[model samples]
Target: MEDGGQAQRAWASNPPTAFIFLITVFAFFLPILIYFPPFPPFRRDALLETHVQVGIQHPSESGLRKSTQKHNAGRSVPVTAEGTARNNAKDGVEETPKTSTDGGRIRSLWIYPIKSCRGIELRQSRVLPTGLEFDRLYMFAQLRSPFPAPSSPSADGSGPVEHTWHFITQRQFPLLATVQVDLFVPKGEADSDKAASGAFLLVRFPWKERGLRGVLESAAAKLSRGWRAQPEKEFVLPVAFPVGSSSSRSPSPVPPGSGQESDAEEGEDVEIEDRRPRGYTHEKVTIWRDTVSALNMEAELPRELRLYLGVSNRLGLFRVDPARLREVRRCAPTPAEAGYQPVAGFQDAYPLHLLNLKSVRDFDAKIDKDKDLQELDPRRFRANIIVDNNDYSSPYDEETWKKIRFTSEPGNRKESNGSNDKKLVPSTFHVSCRTVRCKMPNVDQDSGYRHPVQPDKALRKFREVDEGAKRMGCLGMQVTPLFTNPGLPEGRKSWVEVGMSVEVLERGHHVYILQ
Candidate 1:
């Protein structure tokens, strides 16, 4: 007791020693304070609100069942539009609210010219039976090597084998997102000129090289220092669309090693025109289960573009062949049911993919707080049509929509005169099935960087609700145009634009049939 009293008295007498002890304590914990603060500096929750209030509803509550009448409980009844309205009224059931009255409309339209590459956003686009015109019309393929490939060194065991020319995507090469494509259509007098007769596609990407200088340049560009930054390399090709043919010209011989070897190792920015002859060759390419013949545009590409894309053996640009039509086999009704099997270009499954914005926000709210992930971007989903659900719809409401119709505003709607008047009515589509998602959505469209595990991982927590494929998560609705005729005349063409109102024409449980 006497020794403790003496120590306390000495410590109080020496102010310098007390001050030094306090400084030492702060110094020991300073790093911890700096690294792990009491509160997060940034918060993404301010503008967004959680939408997990409602749990996954039962099938009955989902309103997807056709009807509760004992006679029609389990079977679907084919009825005309007038009959449907009358039946619903007699049953005391309200129709799905119209978008024009409720403020629900198409938020945007995206057309991906080349599969897995950057997409183009448009205010309006021509809607065909096979979806938006030019959507997924082109894709990249890995040319097969003469010798057999060795065992893959990849840890995940995901390297593709067995196929000679398989399609490539962000799953294999995330850097594809860095590539940009622009479309320019000729109009009026410009169409008369032979050189400007066809549309033009401009592709651009960052310059790729090796060595210390290249590494330094890349680092600088990433840092946005603008020190020794190289301009984005670009190339343009003529886009010729035949009236009823696959390509404007027939296949031509593409000689091997046609262009001079690129001097990309030394970081030389070569001009796009000095590289190659303009020609295309027919090639068979495989995309997920179906193999289709596509036009190879390799002769028009520069060797440097291949290296930048990280293709070691060989690469080819493939365009959809109209003659070799690849019909939608998955989730498709039999020919007897629809009179025809819908055809698509290079879409993975369905002709049209529709995403609801409210669902995306709900997904964002479901992400783990501990992971500190950024707000999910709608671009990640890559839907052809982005619909603003507004207040009329809730998250996952699209799953109950069996059929939807898109109506243009009064000014945009066409006036029909005679027999074709029915064709001029609002475009209607049959909702086929739920979109089975893949990790390709984890890749950032703007940065070309992929998250280790993300929105996909978060989705797996609760979105595996599809009866057909409960093992996979679903995000959007896959739809096909409902048309009585496969080949429609020019006057019967339908167009969907941004701000168009969407209405649910029918509601029923979807039987997802995986291809």
Candidate 2:
């Protein structure tokens, strides 16, 4: 009798639920492998996104089950408008408050793709039940440019020499935050397939407001036609300073050899300390310093590599122009001396703002403290995926490759609603995902960045079964299987044969839940 009792207790302690949970997290490492967990398809140019809030109710037939989080390089991942929203969908998600699909009060919504760069400023956007549309759509792939050394050379090629690294991630420089860049829509030719036309250009540089004010002065410029065409939408990019200034320039230098200096060395002073939250030290200038300087002592962007907006994940904020912003050239970099200058030379590729998520405590604290307010630029918190999300939304926030789950049968609503009504049907909405902490460094950085290892060896063992598979959880993915995948052999190579972590890729309509 005693032996039987002990066996039962052991099994109970190691609940079957625990094993499944481990699998869920392990698979979470594979982002591209995951999909939007069954929510409605969300897109931009619509306001479905303003509907996600706790204390709000979603109609069961609101009709919006979609999938998102496209896989990149290898793994699938989920996008975070704010790091991880407390599943406020209907009934509590896991252990979150029940939020309603409201749409009245103006709550700031943000999105950042690739961590940093300039976020797309949206007054009202539709939530593709999956994520922001066209977010992180363009990444700045390193294109060669022709610019000479702005600074003198250094012996070790490490001094404050002319900018060395040509390519920058939105993760490295958050100052690109001040610029306002919109895709060029040629009179009659603009669509997803055709948007990639040969004449892609940014007619105006809205990095600093003065830059916009100067637009009329240079109206005869080659790119002005497109700038005048953009709808006057007041989409503000995030400026990280609590009280500071701004600009709108792009990047231009690339480190040629092992011993090269960054072109941005003039005043690009980045001193991140391990002791405090991350911060920056670039000049507090506007994109139109040259013009302002003519009348008074003002500043202008020294270099053009404003392609990126490097932000620290720990800081919960990105830099923005406190004094309002103007615009600048989305022009291509000139090539001759050495590398490409990111003067909006995105004809082929562009840079993405990559936000770091390694700093856990500082960020989580920010989110916790601001749980009730909806004013300001995302409150420097409330970021669903705060990988250095500046005041604006990221272009990489949208995707269609990740596989996600939409839990429909939420059992009770009153538990989270505090209402006596027990007949609330939890709509089939939401997704379950885990952010994958890879064992690799961020692709952009040359050193320092490293992914965290799993805490448990057993989970590693199971994850090994899916080895060689892409690790996602960039947002972890979860699914209540309509049918569990068949078992796999306990081996590292099991990943090659185990094809169950991803399932169900479909599109659905999206509705908003704003209270």
Q: Estimate each model's TM-score.
A: 0.65, 0.25
lDDT of 2 by residue, 452-501 (tens): 32222212333222112343223222111111211221110100000011
lDDT of 1: 0.64
TM-score (C-alpha, index-matched) for candidate 1: 0.65
Who wins the lDDT comparison? Answer: 1
lDDT of 1 by residue, 238-356 (tens): 44442223534422211112234455553344333335444667778889888888888777577877787788758888877766768786676555555566778889888889987
Looking at model 1, the pairs that clash are none
> What clash count goes with each model?
0, 157
Residue 338 miss distance in model 1 (angstroms): 4.7
